[model samples]
Target chain A: MFLQQIINGLTVGGVYALIALGYTMVYGILELINFAHGEIYMIGAYLGIIFLGIFTTAGLTQYSLPLSLFLTVVLSVLFCSAYGFTVEKLAYKPLRNAPRLNPLISAIGVSIFLQNYVMLTQGATDKVFPHVLPVTTIEFSGITMTSLQIIIIVVSLLLMAGLHLFIMKTRTGKAMRAVAQDKVMASLLGIDIDRIISVTFIIGSGLAAVAGLMVAMYYGLVNYSIGYIAGIKAFTAAVLGGIGSVPGAMIGGFVLGLIESLGAGYLSSEYKDAYAFIVLILILMVKPTGLLGKSEGHKP
Target chain B: MLKLENIHTSYGHIEAVRGTNLEIRKGEIVSLIGSNGAGKSTTLMTISGILRPVKGKVIFEGREIQGLSPHKIVSMGVSQVPEGRRIFPKLTVRENLEMGAYLKGKGQRAKGKGSGVKGQEARGKGEDTSRGDSRIALAEQLDHIFNLFPVLKERQKQLGGTLSGGEQQMLAIGRALMSGPELLLLDEPSLGLAPIIVIKIFKTIRELNAGGLTILLVEQNAKAALRLAHRGYVIESGRVTREGIGKELLDDPAIKRAYLGE
Candidate 1:
């Protein structure tokens, strides 16, 4: 039971981490929470579902599972990135030099606007995700595992690894780091601050979309309101790890996922969300900067 | 060469730099000396593209740069070691230096100027491989800086925020050097430092100038700034009150009484 719970926790944690990366990256550079980010994740899942439905209706099933998944991931990421870019250009960029709280409010406004818009367009009902994935069970040494669980874990790990590499090893990644450290200084060093910020949104939103698609596939359904709870949970994970820390978000996601899974398994499924909240509160009480956050000392 | 003509900058309603004019020839260390709130920093900020002038023409290397973004100005080979030594607190000294070389690295890679295959690209150019390479090159240029301030080489691994104020200043200047800038804009290098440290920093500034780096320095220490600079401009309330050779200004009775405390 413990091992099973661990697996389940890891799967959920992976999804949270993916979504949390977007929030953390955007916040790291802009110092804004980007409340609309969660909705962007929801949009990703809906986009994937729409693409899958189209493919199925068009009778293109001869494509292998891997190929279909690849196509879905590509299309979903592109769509979400564009969505995120437009959000920044239209909503946030105009208020760049405005007061901090102004952007925060605008972000919330965007979030609510996206949520209601999705509801009106897609309808309130949860659309069923087609179970196209093969469900072969693999049993080894009394540990039974489904292909879905394994695939989710593997894909999540791969995506996280890719993100890590991109941030640490690329020029654009370095630029992002530079901007995060000091926007003015970064600009003085010849980094196009606007371009770096745009790229940051794109990357963050792209990862969120992937998480959304995965969550929809694993759960077999997605709804417009899915962003609310999932967004909160992922944000909780982001805060748990460290608000602006990338690795912190990953750690926070897994911890939250583990806590929720174990709480659901041993205590009560009804209190699963309560477990996450409890962890968040406990973490905040102990280490307000999150697990991996650096305490930024005040400069007099 | 850099020139600023009739530059006017404001902070909201209050005009900070009121039609300031200044010029620095190649290979010269020109100092702008003033009392606090005299708009010395504003002039440097305007030149470095941090603050846009409300009215003025800033020409650098024969191109107008008054309205250009800070980063674009940097790409044109102008870099600033800003006030308060704004180094990335979390990043290691090395990482901070790498960011300085961001644009130069791209230019180098685009032109294929250096070694082929065994060059910067071979050094594990990560995400912005080309950009990273330039930054790495920028880091390599630090040997010159380290030669000037050997203490930085000793504490290269330390987080920038952890350094002493003087050490932080050195790191800031060192980081700026990594960018291989043609014109270095320094804002108050002597703001908060011991007299001995101030002397050492000024001496290093002189050495850098001797080595052919053009510098536009804003300083509160009028005596020391004038001593080191080839030429001097006295700015009062954001306008040039006087300008002349450094020694001429230093000997001026009015400058000596008001600024030099003679």
Candidate 2:
């Protein structure tokens, strides 16, 4: 039972890390905590369900698993990218030159708006996600693992690896980093700061959508409320890893996952969320900038 | 090569540049010298497209660039090293230079001509959508900047934020040069630097102008700016008060008393 719970924790935590990356990346660049990002994740799952419904109605279920997953991911990415772009243009861009607090409030407003909008459209009821993958279990050393768990882990890792490479090597990736460092300077040097920022949102929201789809598959159901807890936990992971650090979010997610799992196994299962929060508090108290965050000194 | 015609710019309700006119011809260093708050920086910002003018036009290389975006102005080959050495502090010195050559490389790649490991990628992407070429051009331009500022070559891997003040100024200039612009707009290049570093920077500016780079400089240090410039403009309260040859302005009694601190 303990081993099974560990696997479960790892699977869920992997998805949380994926979602957390978007938050960390956006915050890293703009210093804007996009409260609406989790709702973007929720929307991704909803998009997947909508696509699946359309495909099933069209009788495309006979397609191979790989092709189906590819279609799901492509459609989800397109939807999420468009959604992220719209969110930025409407909610964030207008308030860009305004006071920082204005945009922060706007982000929260967007979050609430998206949540309620989904609730209104989807009737506030939990929608059951159809099983898209085989549920075969593989046992090793008295530990049982589901095929879905393996798929989630592998897919998340691959996506993370791809993201890491893109940030480190690609031209647009470099532009994003340049803008994050200094928007005015980047503009002076001929970088389109606004375009890079939009691309950042696109990448971040796309990742969130992928995480949403994976989580929906893993849990077999989703609701408008799904984004809230998952969003909080993912945010905690981001903070734990260092809010602006990409690799930090990944490490933070795994550590939080393990802590929650072990706490559930050795202590009370009801205390799992509490345990994660307690660890977060401890981490913050010890290092407010986060585990991997550097304290930047401003020149007076 | 560049002209600001009766341009008016403001910050919120406060008018910073009120009907200011300025010009910089090809192969000349034209300095705008004034006291702080006299709209010198505001004028530069307006030309750089960071601040759009409330009224008037900016003609550069015979093209009207008024109301254009900053990035678009850059694409038109007018590069500004803004006030305060706003280097991308988190990026390496090398990466900072690469950004300058973004559009040039993009153009080169669009033409489908270059030789290097990265050139193939650029050629394949083509001119209309060749991010790869722009990247390669940026790398090549970095090498040119490294040669121009050898210290930067030594500290190529160092983060822009970690550079010393003098080094940061050099990096800012070098970053702008990477774009290979026909015209360079410099805003207060000597602010907060030691006398020795300021002299070195001014000397470099003179050398760059002599090498056929048209320059429009804004400076608070009137004496130093006038010494290096061929022509000078004196602005006060957001308008041009006087314009003359650099030596004539330096010798003017009113200019000496007010700006040159006789």
Candidate 3:
């Protein structure tokens, strides 16, 4: 039972880690808590449903489930990337130089706008994601695993690894880091600051789109409001790991996932949501910088 | 190679550079000497397209580049080592140098038109192996910088923030050099360094100038700047108050009293 819970915890943690990456990366570059990022993830979920619905209606799902799923992911990622880019351009770009508080408020406004926009258009009710992925169980050493669980963990791992390599080995990634460190200096070195910020949004949103698809598949349901709870939980995960640190988000996400899952299973399933916050508060009290975060210190 | 004609730059309602005119000839080190808030950095910022002048033209190599973006200006071969040695602190020495060569890498990918690479591809770095030429060029530049400041080579793996102030300044200049700039704008390279280190930096600047690289230097150390410069301009209250050949400005009694600490 304990081992089975670990598997379940890992599956959920992988999704949280994916969503938390969007929050952490945006915050890393802009120093603003992109309150609307959760909305982007929520939008990703809706886009996945909408696209998968189209594929089903067109009879593509009858041809091959994998191909249909692939097309759906690709379309959702593209749309989510566009949404992320447009949000930065419309909502955040104009306020780049404004006082810190102004952008924070603007972000909140964007969050509300996106949530309402989805609710008004897609309706406030829970939307059913098309049932396409085959449900098969794999039992090993008294633990049962679903193919979907393996798929979720594999997809999340691939995306994170790809992101890590991109940030470490690519010129654009280095430029992003440079911009994060010092905007003016990065500009002087020929890095287009605005473009880098846009790229951040696109990447973050793309990852969220994949996570949205996985979650929809796992639970077989999604709602406009799902982004709020998931976003707050992922954000708590970000803070728990380290708000601006990429690795921190990954670690924080899994940690929160495990804590919540184990707490719900062993103690009380009624207070599953509270476990994340409880651990977050405890971690913050002990190591405010989060697990992988560097402590703020005086510059020489 | 660069000229700022009757430029006026401002921060909101308050103008910082009011009708400032300056010129730098090819292969000459022209130093702009002034006190703090006298528009020294503002003029450089304007030249680099970091600050768009409210009025007037910035002509570089006879092209009007006043309204260009900062990256556009950098691609055009004008790079600035900004004030305070603003090296990316968290980046390692090698990574910082790699960032300096960012435009060079972009320039290559942009040339392959049929590959659908936008001059600014925002998705991620492409898998194209077309970086061969730029990669070689980057290595040459890195070697040049390491040779110029051997200590940087030794500390190539260290994070930029861990470097001492003098070493950071050297890294800043090296990073700028990696951009392969024609006209380099350095703002207060001598700021917050020991005298010996300052002299060494000045020596490197003189060496670079000797190699035929044109430079526009802004300095509060008027005497050293004038001595190294081919010509000098003393800016005060947002305008060029005095202009002369290096020694001519160095020996002027008024310049001595106002800036030379008579």
Candidate 2 interface RMSD (Å): 1.2
Each prediction's Cα lDDT score? 0.84, 0.83, 0.87
lDDT of 2 by residue, B19-53 (tens): 99888887788999988899998898888888899
Clashing pairs in 3: none
* Recovery fraction of native interface contacts for candidate 3: 0.94
Among all candidates shown, the one with the greatest DockQ: 3
Candidate 1 lDDT over residue span A7-60, tens digit each = 889989999989899889998998899889999999999999988777767666
Candidate 1 ranges with C-alpha deviation above 4 Å? A140-144, A297-300, B108-142
Q: Please, what is the TM-score per model? A: 0.91, 0.91, 0.93
Error of 2 at A151 (Å): 1.9
Model 3 / residue A298 / CA error / Å: 10
Error of 2 at A93 (Å): 1.2
True-vs-predicted CA distance for residue A290, candidate 2, Å: 1.5
Q: Which candidate is the best by lDDT?
A: 3
What TM-score is obtained by chain A of candidate 3? 0.97
- Candidate 2's chain A scores what TM-score? 0.95
lDDT score, residue B51, model 2?
89
Candidate 2, A52-82: lDDT as tens digits: 7677666676666667667888999899999
Question: What is candidate 3's lDDT per residue for A166-186, written digit by digit as tens?
Answer: 998899898988987888889
TM-score of chain A of each: 0.96, 0.95, 0.97
lDDT of 2: 0.83
